[model samples]
Structures are given as structure tokens and as C-alpha cells.
Target chain A: MAQVLSLHAAERRQLAAWACDAYPHEACGLMLGVSEADGVRVLEVRRARNLNVERARDRYDIDPADYLAAEREATARGCELVGVWHTHPDHPARPSPTDLALAWPGWSYVIAAVTAAGMTELRAWRLNGGHQFDEESIEEADPS
Target chain B: MSHIVIRIPTPLRGHTAGADEVPVEARSVGEALARLGELHPGILERVLDGDGQPRQFVNIFLGSGNVRALDGMNTPVRDGDVLAIIPAVAGGGHESGGCKTESPSGTDYRA
Candidate 1:
């Protein structure tokens, strides 16, 4: 059976806004409180430098210290870092090669693509051990 | 011409009228994207900059590899090549202190 991973409508809107806000430069951040029973919950969002200065692409580092702190906080809250997300400017929201190599097995990778027309496209994926991508769908609900 | 698949995200599905994936053909990534633009009309600006280069936050993958390490949008694709686009996700708590020491580059956390 295929497992479905999704984001709340409010969270989806927030992520879309972030993707557009961090335009031109790739935005990097993490998702917190991912639970199988509760589904994926998006927590904090952070924007980081691409670090790939030469190519000006979307490479990221979560400030090792900050990353550890996030892990500890999640553990304390009995949550898991179940998913990771990023932005794609002017491209469809999908997983890239670096995304595949960087993605950890069992984690959901989310990508948000921002368009020149000021639109945001969000998609999710899972990386197989063979480094192949399995596309996941996002079911959106009316934002109340 | 080989067909390349462009996967659409939910948020942007309105642009494709909720179509999850669209197929296009071109010799290079740019041409393929141009084909995508022809079908989608105004999506190119969203994925590319005024200079015709991919935006900084967006990452393009040709098959299982990142185009950045390759020739970027110029990377060649044959029939059945799957191109995946990934955007950046940000947001998290910052460390107050103690954990501020920078580690050497290239350290794998899981190793």
C-alpha cells in the first residue's frame, strides 16, 4: 500500500508564501512534529544561504547547532523529523538530484516552486534506496 | 524526440488545472522547459530568472542527479528521462549558545 503524506491547508499556504518570499535564492529549512498517526505537521521555517556560491544553486546547512537543538526539541516533544522541504524558483516543484542524494530514507522531501507570475507549486517525494523518486500527492482542503 | 515528464505540485496544480504530470519533448533542459512554457504559458519565469538561468532556490534534477553538478538546464535528456524539481524549505529554532562551534565541512551526521 502507498502511504499518503500531506500538509495542512494553513501550513501549505505558509510554505507557499515562504517559497515566494525567498525568491532568486533557494530557501532551506526543516519540518517538525511529523507523525504517522497525525500526518505531517510543519513546524518552524528558516531561510539559509545556498552555500553553493559558485553555481548559485539551492544548497543548505542548518547551522549544526540549530539542527541539534531542533532534534532535541522534537524528541522532548515526542515528535520525529519526518520530513524536509525546500523551494524551487521558476521551476516546477519536484525533487532534484542533490535532493535525492541528500534525502534520508523514510523521510518525506517537500519542494515548493515559485513562478514569475507570483504563484507557488508544492510537491512531496520519497527517495528509494536506489536513489529514485516516488512522487507523493498533496490533498488540499478549504482554508477555514 | 524523447518525452520528459514534468511533475506538478498541488499548490501549483491550478496552473495545470490539477493535472499532476505533463509530458513534453526537447533536446536540452531549456528547450524542454520552453515546451513546458508553451503548454503552461507563464511558468518559465517562476523557474528561471531574467537571465534565463534557474532561480537560486530552485534545484533541477535530470534523472537521479542534480543539474548543477552537470550542465544545468543544458543537461541532455533522452526519452523516459524523469526530471524532478525541488524547492527549498526553511524555518526552525536557532541555538542560543554552546552548539555554535562550526564543524568541519563534509561531515555526514549519520555516519
Candidate 2:
């Protein structure tokens, strides 16, 4: 039983495009949304710069300032930063070992897999109460 | 007295009274941090070990360069310089419910 994440179809495409644009390197961003009884709903996406220039191939450091600013904006909009999204070039759409260690509970972690051929897949995961990442299902919703 | 801006990372901002960037007057990195700790109690314990040295997981940057590359704790400061206190972002090294925390060896600090 995986958690569900309701995201706008347009935003889903936008994130995949961003991942493609950063081909050969990892791209990351912040997701602002609300948590419902069943899962989470993504209302907005904020792109972030990957400051990990030295190891963009296997690691990403989303500018903390960007995260802080997005959180502030989400607060202003009556929503919360419910998750983070990042790309994994030529890697599987699964949370890596490092991802498991850095992830905090109760937030969705959406991973996009991009390669020279473009984005191959996108998936989401959430840290369970036991601190292990459980696969999440993405529900692309039509814009309201 | 130079007024240096200390940028607080998200994980440690709760100890800063919710301030992201705190400005303080001091002459060096060590002095500025000591002043910051005075202004916001309980922060020093998070970044410093019982020996008063920066913990292994904590990184202090003066401008774009790491303080370790310059002079460690004795790194000089100038007016308008930015001092960033960044916690090492790492995970999966051990099996724990969450990030690790260690209390100052002999201090009664809670953060």
C-alpha cells in the first residue's frame, strides 16, 4: 500500500522537461502542496539550482536558501512544502542509499530519471514511519 | 569591530530563534560564532564538540571558501563578510531512525 501524490499533469510534464534540460547532470526542485487524509496534493513546483558542482553526476545539493524561500512562499499561500523532486541521470527511479539517509519522514520524494535520450521515468516515494522509503503512486490530475 | 553576517542553515535555525541570517560584530570567525552563541543560547553545543572545536559534521564557510582552508577557527573576518554555518548533508551511512545527535559531554543543552 503506497501513498498517493496528486499532481497537476502540466506540472508533471514541466518537471520532466526540467530534468531533461539538465541532462548528464542532476536537477532538483521543491514541491509545495497540502497533505490530505489519503496522501499529498502538489499545488506548485519551484525549481532549484544544484549547487553540488563537483559531483552533479551522482549527488545534488539543492540550495538551502531556495528551500527556505519556497517554504516561506508556501506558508504565505496557506500550503506547505510537502516534498522534494530531483533527477537521476541514467539511474533508476528509486531512492538511493544516500537519499534514504537524508530523507525526513512525512514528505514525498519524487525522482525523475533522465538520460541523453531524455526523461525515461518519474516516480515518487515517501519515508514510512520506520524510516524506510516506500514507493508512492503518482496521480496526474487535470488542472482545476 | 566588524559586523559579519552568519547564515544559519535550516536544521539549526530553530536554535537561532527562527532567524536565517544573524548579523553580529566580531573580529574573527571564532569570535563571531562565540557572539552568536551568546545571542542565541544552545547553538554552540550543536556545532561544537566538547573540546570547543567544530564538530566533524559541521562546516563553517567564510565567503566562498571553507574556514579550514584558511585558518580554521582563527580565520579573520571583515565588515560585511558572510559566514555560513552549514551542516554536513549525508545519509545512509548507518542504521538509525533519524539523524544522529550527541549532547555536549558535560552541558545541559537541549536543541
Candidate 3:
């Protein structure tokens, strides 16, 4: 039900670090948080292993095992897996066709456009019916 | 009949009335899912293809065992079993580390 993505400052910083640390390879992760009436509040950003070794530079596949662990962690902390975040090494902070193909409804997606110059942009999105993405606004919020 | 719990992922929670976990009674994975479809209308279409097979982008797990690695839809279920449906989270750029694309693109709206 969340149409927007709100990130705690620390989580945002962590995502940024993940983007840069992965460098030329695409970085993938899970966002754990609570869903609010207006937006999804991201309390934590967990970097998951990208299993797409063959396409490491241009693609990412979050390991299912990591996803299982993330879901358990979220449950233990009384939160939900509200979103997924990834970096497009040198690409724009936008959803690709493959992104749409693998996306699920009711989850926010955050993309960071990273380059040798560092992260240039961070954008949020949600997939709706008809296999399309609707951009969502990102906000910096205080932790609960 | 076994009383099973299906762990609904966030993406499917909308169709599940926002309930993360739902209980059902069934004897096999297929029956459990069929009951879930009846309990949550819009979910089945997303999880299954027209041919009734699991969607390529969706993964179903009976506890820690992936159904695909087991008996799939025919996998037996026991009381207190947990079935989890997780969407495959994936995406990528071009091989050059830049997301070069030539296909007709989907609309990209800015908020």
C-alpha cells in the first residue's frame, strides 16, 4: 500500500556505500521495514549476494538463500521485506526490462546510479499492473 | 487434512489483505495453493502461469526445500508446514557495465 519510500539516513548512507563498494559490478540487496499508509519506511538495507556472476557488470540476482535469511531477519525484528535496492554501476537510476520482468507488486524498488564519480542519483519505484513502474518519491526520515 | 501456513511475501500481501501469513488446510502443495487462491483471489494469477506451472519469476518453498527441487505441485504437506512464495529479485545493465538498451522501452515517469 506504500506509494513512496522513506529511508532512515543511516540506511541511505549504507546503501550508498554498498553501491560504491561494489564498483563496476551491480550490487543487490533487500530493504526491511514497515509499510505505512503513504510510504514504506526503510529501517534497514541488507546487502545480499548477487549470484549472477556471469553478468556481474550489468546484472544482479539476489541469492534466494539470502532472501530467505532476510525475510527471517525482518520477521525477527518485527518488520517486513518492503523493498529491494540495487545499483546500476554506470547506468541511470531507472528500472530495466529485466527489472520489470522479475518485479513483484506491493514492493518498492530503489536504484542508485553509480559511477567512478560516486553515486549520482538515488531513485525509488513501484511496479503496478501491466508490467510498468511508477516512480515514487524518496524521503529521509527519523528512525522509529 | 494438514493445517498448513503459507508465508506470503510482501508483494503478494496486497492480495492477502496484508496478512503476512495465512493458514489453510490441505494434503499437498498444489492443494494448499489452490485453497490460497480461493482465499486470496488475485494471488494465483501472479504465482502461476496459464498452464498452472509456477511462474519463472516466482519461487515456492516448502519450508527450506524449494518445491522445484522436490515434487513441485505434488509435494506432500504436513501439519504446521510453511510454504513461502518469494519473487525473484533480479535486474541488470548492459555487458559494458552501462545499461545500454535497444528494445522499445517502457514508460519511465518521474515523481
| Best candidate, lDDT | 3
Candidate 3, position B25, lDDT: 100
Provide the lowest-lDDT 10-residue window in model 2 chain A.
Answer: A97-106
Tell me candidate 2's fraction of native contacts, as a decimal between 0 and 1. 0.12
lDDT of 2 by residue, B35-78 (tens): 99999999898777777778765677787777877998888899
> What would the per-residue lDDT of candidate 1 be over residues B1-111, giving only the tens digit for each residue?
778887543333446775646799888887887888899976666566667776654556676577778997788889988665544332211112222221111122221
Model 3 local distance difference test score: 0.84
lDDT of 2 at B66: 76
What TM-score, to 2 decimals, does candidate 1 have? 0.50
Model 2: CA > 4 A from native? B1-111
Which stretches of candidate 1 lie above 4 Å from their native place? Answer: A37-56, A141-144, B1-111
What CAPRI-style quality would you assign to candidate 3? acceptable
Candidate 3 stretches with Cα past 4 Å from truth are A1-3, A128-131, B95-111
On TM-score, who's better, 2 or 3? 3
lDDT of 2 by residue, A46-90 (tens): 898787787777777776556656766775797777788888888
Score residue A11 of candidate 1 by CA lDDT. 73
